[model samples]
Target: MKLYHYPLSGHAHRARLFMSLLGIPHELVEVDLKSGAHKTPEFLALNSFGQVPVLDDNGTMISDSNAILVYLATKLGRTDWLPTDAKGAAGVQRWLSVAAGDVAFGPAAARLVTVFGAKFNPEDVIGRAHVLLKRLEAHLADRDWVVGTGPTIADVALYSYLSSAPEGNVDLSAYPRVNALLRRIEALPGFVPFAKTAVGLAAAA
Candidate 1:
């Protein structure tokens, strides 16, 4: 297996983290996004979208971080990572949607504006981050894991950007439950953390 990724990309980290948690050994091929390597003709053949974190499992390529998590979990037959029952699977799917939707638009986008110099309204994305964090804090109040009894891909899906939310100036201190959840995930075996960028709030400090 080969993972084409960028170190600073949370999307790429999610895929890499899961494989590590499951003890799946693979090769890491860093894509030089700064130099427009992702847009090259060779890269386009792997993913037309020209994004990082494309997984190549023996020539079968999978794009999208969430989709890659699903593929790897299901392929490995790891029910704990992704439930098999309808209700359990649906529960995981809900957060996966949140990861792609609210989490993407909120915390992830906020980080993009600061860390990546993306042209998005800082106030807008910060507001979105707070809103999403409030909801997640409430949801995680009574549950240690996102779904079922053990950690799932949903947790992996949301962990990267949310853990690095401080870089976006979306404070995590207000959400203690969210913080506890992050700490728990960090303590999990084989957990590989996303690389941190000391910008945004860190710079202000």
Candidate 2:
């Protein structure tokens, strides 16, 4: 398998994290998003969206980080990572949705704004982030992981960007439960730190 990815992308990190955790041996093909490599004809053939983190599992090409997680988990027959039971599957799916929806819009996009200077309306995203963080804090009050007793794809999907909320000027200090959840995910074996990159602005030297 070959993964086309950018190191700084949380979505790309999701695939990398899962592969590392499962000890899946594959090649990493870095896509230069700044140089528009992902928009080239070669990459467009793999994914029309022109996104990073496209996985080529032999002949089967999969895009979207969450979808890739499902594909890999199913292929490996590691249902524990994704759960097979109806209710359990739904719970996993719910968190994946949260990752894509609220998490992406809030922490991820906000980080893009703060880090890369992306045109983000702070009044718009920051308030939404606070609301989402509060809800997550309350939800995680009694659970270690998002869905089940152990870590699942849901946790992998949300952990990257959500854990880096401080970079976006989103104060996670208000959410102790959510912070604990982040620590738990980080304490997992084979965990990798999210790589920082020049997104919207250059980091202070």
Candidate 3:
């Protein structure tokens, strides 16, 4: 298996974290997003959309971080990270939606703008991110993880971007509950720190 990703990307970090937790061995192929490497003809053949964190498992290609999480969890028989029961599954899915939607658009985009100069309206997204953080704070008030009583793909999917929210100047001082959740995820065994480039982007092109 080959994971084409940028080391600093939170989306890519989610996949790396899961692979480490599952003890799955695969080659890490870095894609350079700055130099337009992801847009090149050679890379476009692998993923027409030309995004980082594209996973090549044998001949099967999977894009999107959450989809990769589901694929790996299923393949490694680590369903505990993604429960089989309908309610449990839905709970995980719900958080996944939050990760892709609110989390991505708000804190994640805010960070990209601050650190990478991505064209985003930080003032608008910062307020939205605060609202999302409040929701997470309330949800995590009495729970250790997002979905199940234990950590799940939901937590992994959300942790990377949420942990780095401060990079975007989004203060986390008010969300103690969310802070606790971040600490718990950081303390997980076999956890690999999300590696970011000095420029705050992923390692691969």
Best by TM-score: 1
| Candidate 3 Cα errors over 4 Å, as ranges | 196-205
Q: Considering TM-score, which of the candidate structures 1 and 3 is the better prediction for this target?
A: 1
Give a tens-digit lDDT track for model 3, residues 86-108. Answer: 99999999999999999999989
Write one digit per residue (lDDT tens) for candidate 1, span 1-205. Answer: 9999999999999999999999999999999999999999999999999998999999899999999999998998989899999999999999999999999999999999988899999999999999999998889878998898789999999999999998999988889999998999999999998998888886665
Candidate 1 at residue 57, lDDT?
A: 94
Using TM-score as the measure, name the better of candidate 1 and candidate 2.
Answer: 1
- Among these predicted structures, which one has the highest lDDT? 1
Candidate 1: Cα lDDT at 189: 92
Query: Candidates' TM-scores?
Result: 0.98, 0.94, 0.93
Better of 1 and 2 by lDDT: 1
C-alpha lDDT values of all predictions: 0.93, 0.87, 0.87
lDDT of 2 by residue, 1-205 (tens): 9999998789999999998888899899999988999999999999999997999999899999999999999999998898999999999999999999999898888888876678989767877788899999889888888998998999999988887777777778789888888888888888887886543322331
Clash tally, candidates in order = 0, 5, 11
- Candidate 1 vs candidate 3, lDDT winner: 1
